[model samples]
Target: MSVVLAGGGSAGHVTPLLALADCLRRRDPATRITVLGTAEGLEARLVPARGYELVQLPKVPMPRRPGPDLLRIGGRLREAVRAAGAALDAAEADVVVGFGGYVCPPAYLAARRRGTPIVIHEANPLPGLANRLGARLTPYVATTFPHTPLPHAVQTGVPLRHEISDLARADDAERLARRLLAREHFGLDLDRTTVLVTGGSLGAQRLNDTFGEAAPDLRAAGAQVLHVSGTGKQVEVRQSAGGAGDDVPPYVVVPYVDAMEQAYAAADLVVCRAGANTVCELATVGLPAAYVPLPVGNGEQRLNAEPVVAAGGGLLVDDADCTAGWVREVLVPLLQDAAALRAMGEAAARFVVPDADERLADLVEAAVEGRRVPS
Candidate 1:
């Protein structure tokens, strides 16, 4: 079987598509998988490196307001749709799976015109423009969150990395052993509970500033910090926490944690942004979180964190107010309470769907066969 996946722009879109692609290839090594993305999107680099074919399309981002850009978008979209059709023909895709992004809409349309099966996966609680449009074109729709409003949308949890999915389903004894081993290997203070803070690959300056400010309080509460303060922000963040004179600093700051699985294993609690993938990974790894949702556009970040918070697995913090005082007052106390942390971790582990990759692969197979998928 041949499959075409459409998505790219950020890791949020690309990662899930890759996860699904990996699942398909594993299930049947003979399966041909092609990724449709714009030359400008992240998929150009990621898809090829993953050993999948990448077909580039002209990016046609829809304008938000009335402007000359809006007028030019129609012509660009037509050309993109043509390009997508040509790619699909070249690959002879039996089914097109879309993980919503700018590249998806045109590809979805092209697949529909060719009478190829279409499957749409929306990772955000609030559906993006591309997936929203794609959902109308196909009844085979899946979402990471249950509340996403779409026609025939089924709750098939976000497909995740194999490492995270395995960790999620591991026995408690095994999980604990790995966590302890990871902490020791990282030279983390075993005496203090670990608090992992990250702002993803590029890092978030807001997290750096506030978390740094609250380092003293966190340490006083017997919690040690593992802060991935983005790339260039580390120097200033470390200096702000307290320079070289600071005695045995409680916070271990790094630009990035190359092995995120290890970081997740070492964490008792996490403090970070509430991206779709991040939320799923945190829940899968069974770690309680204090989510500071990005205070920007459509408020999707807050919505993404709501389910986990509701399940008693995490807490949501407003971006502007995620300051030292808030961390000291709320997060510090939670970290110090071992019982509460354990309960939260249990709740998180219970809430995740450990076989999301397999489950979504089933959906793709169903779509290809023109069978109705259970909602």
Candidate 2:
């Protein structure tokens, strides 16, 4: 089977596309997979590294207001569609799968014009413009969260890397062993309750500042913090924590966590932004979190964490209130309660759909065969 997967702009869009590609390869090593992206998107780097053919198109963002760019939008979109059409034809694509980003709409339109099957996977509870458009073209729509107001949307969960999925779905003994191993590998205290603080690749300034201020309190409560302050942002956090100590400090400040699975394993609780992928991964691994939604855009980040938080798996703190005071009053007490933590973790695990990648792959195969399910 020949498949063309589309998405890009951020890791949220690209990661799932790679996961789907991995699933397609595992299902049939001979299946040809091509990824559609733009030169500006992260997929330009990530897709090629994953060993998939990447077709680059011009980035065409939807303008929110009237401007000179509005006139140029039509020309740019047409160019992107034409490029995508050529890529699809060249790949002999049986199905075009989109994860919903800047590149998806043109890819969807191109595939639709060619009468090729289109499958869309929406990672957020709030559907983006591209996936919403794709959903109108086909009933084969999959979503990470339930009730994501889109046409024929099925709750298939988010496609995660095999390593993460397997670890998340592991049995009691295996999961425990892996977690222990991860802590040892990271040189983290096995006895201490570990809290992971991350704000994403470039990092969130608010998270870094607030967490740095709260680090001492976190340590006083017998909890160790692993704060990933993004690239080049760790120095400020270290300075805030009284510079780098000779001994293993209660709070470890790192620029980035390249091996995120290890960080996840070493963490008993998480404090981070509520990106779609982050919420899904946390739920999958049964980790409780204090999610601070990014205070920007269409408020989609808050929407992403709503279900998990509602299900008693996590807490949603508004961006404005995610300060040191809030952490001292709420987070510290929560960490102190071991029973509550376990219960929340159980709730998170139960809320997750373990086999989303395989299930979505089945949907892709069906689409390739011209068999369209009602959702």
Candidate 3:
């Protein structure tokens, strides 16, 4: 049997697809998993590395702003759907699952025309524009959040790295993570609080710029900061730190963190955005974070962060209020109060669903096996 895994344009979307692929392979090794994505997406490298056949399409995002550019995006959407239909014909896929991103438009619409069972995993608390538009094309809707707005929602939580999953299951998530990879790889101080600052793989400009000004204070607190600066911002971020320490200052900055499992494990606190999949992973790992939802359309990141914050597992800082002083103000006391930090960590642990991968695999299995079974 063949399964089509569709989602990308960013690392956040690809991570879950990788997770589900791992689960599906174990359940049914004979399964041939094909990844359908755009040529310009991050999937170009990610999919092939995972040993899956990649079906590339042509598409671009519906830009955040309004104007005539919307017309171009609409044209691409139509062309992408047609491209996906062609791929489906070539692959003879039995089922197609969309993990959400710009890739959803083609995967969902094409699969619908082929009468292939369609499944969508909405990985944001507030659905993205692509996901909200794609939901109507599929009856099988799965969610990373427990109470997302999608219809017929099955709470699947988030699929994590294979190593992270194994570590989390061994009852020594922190220790296993430490041994499996060294924080020193990123030049982080093992004795000090290691706060990871990242805005997904492409990097968040606002996050990088904001964290830049706070580096001095963070270093003075005896904290080590590992900032993942996407693209050309590495020099600026490093310069922003102002030589906060000696021995490379243990203030590391990288363009992209290829080994993300170590990053999460080494982090005592996280300063980042809250995308649906990442939030689930953070909760699973029981790490407290100060989240600044990207101040973009619909405040989607805030929506994603709400449940965890409400549960006392994390803090939410609006973008307008997120500044260097604000970062130190929230984190300084939290880091100083070890007991409160531990409590918040424990709160985060409460949100994890241990059997999420298996459960999601079962749902996919049922769809591929057939819908109308004898009672």
Best by lDDT: 2
TM-score for each model? 0.91, 0.93, 0.89
What TM-score does prediction 3 earn? 0.89
Which residue runs does candidate 2 get wrong by more than 4 Å? Answer: 64-71, 238-248
Which window of ten consecutive residues has the lowest lDDT sum in model 1? 235-244
Q: Candidate 3 on 1-375: residue-level lDDT in tens?
A: 788988988877898888898889988899888898878888888888888889888866755445687576777788888988888888899989888777777788889888998877787776766676667776667777777887677777777767667545546764655733657677666677778888877778878877777777776677777888886665254343445336433667888877776788778888788877678778877889888887877777788888889999999988778887887887877877878888988898787877677767777877787663111
Ranking by lDDT: 2, 1, 3
Angstrom error of the Cα, residue 215, model 2: value is 1.3
lDDT of 1 by residue, 9-79 (tens): 87788888988999989999999999998787768888898899999888889643346875777888899
* Model 3 misplacement above 4 A: 60-75, 172-181, 235-249, 372-375
Which digits, one per residue and each the tens of the lDDT, describe model 2 over residues 86-113?
A: 9999999999999988788899999999
Q: Summing lDDT over every window of 10 consecutive residues in candidate 3, give the lowest-scoring window.
A: 235-244
Error of 3 at 276 (Å): 1.2
Comparison by lDDT, 1 against 2, better one: 2
1 or 3, which is superior by TM-score? 1
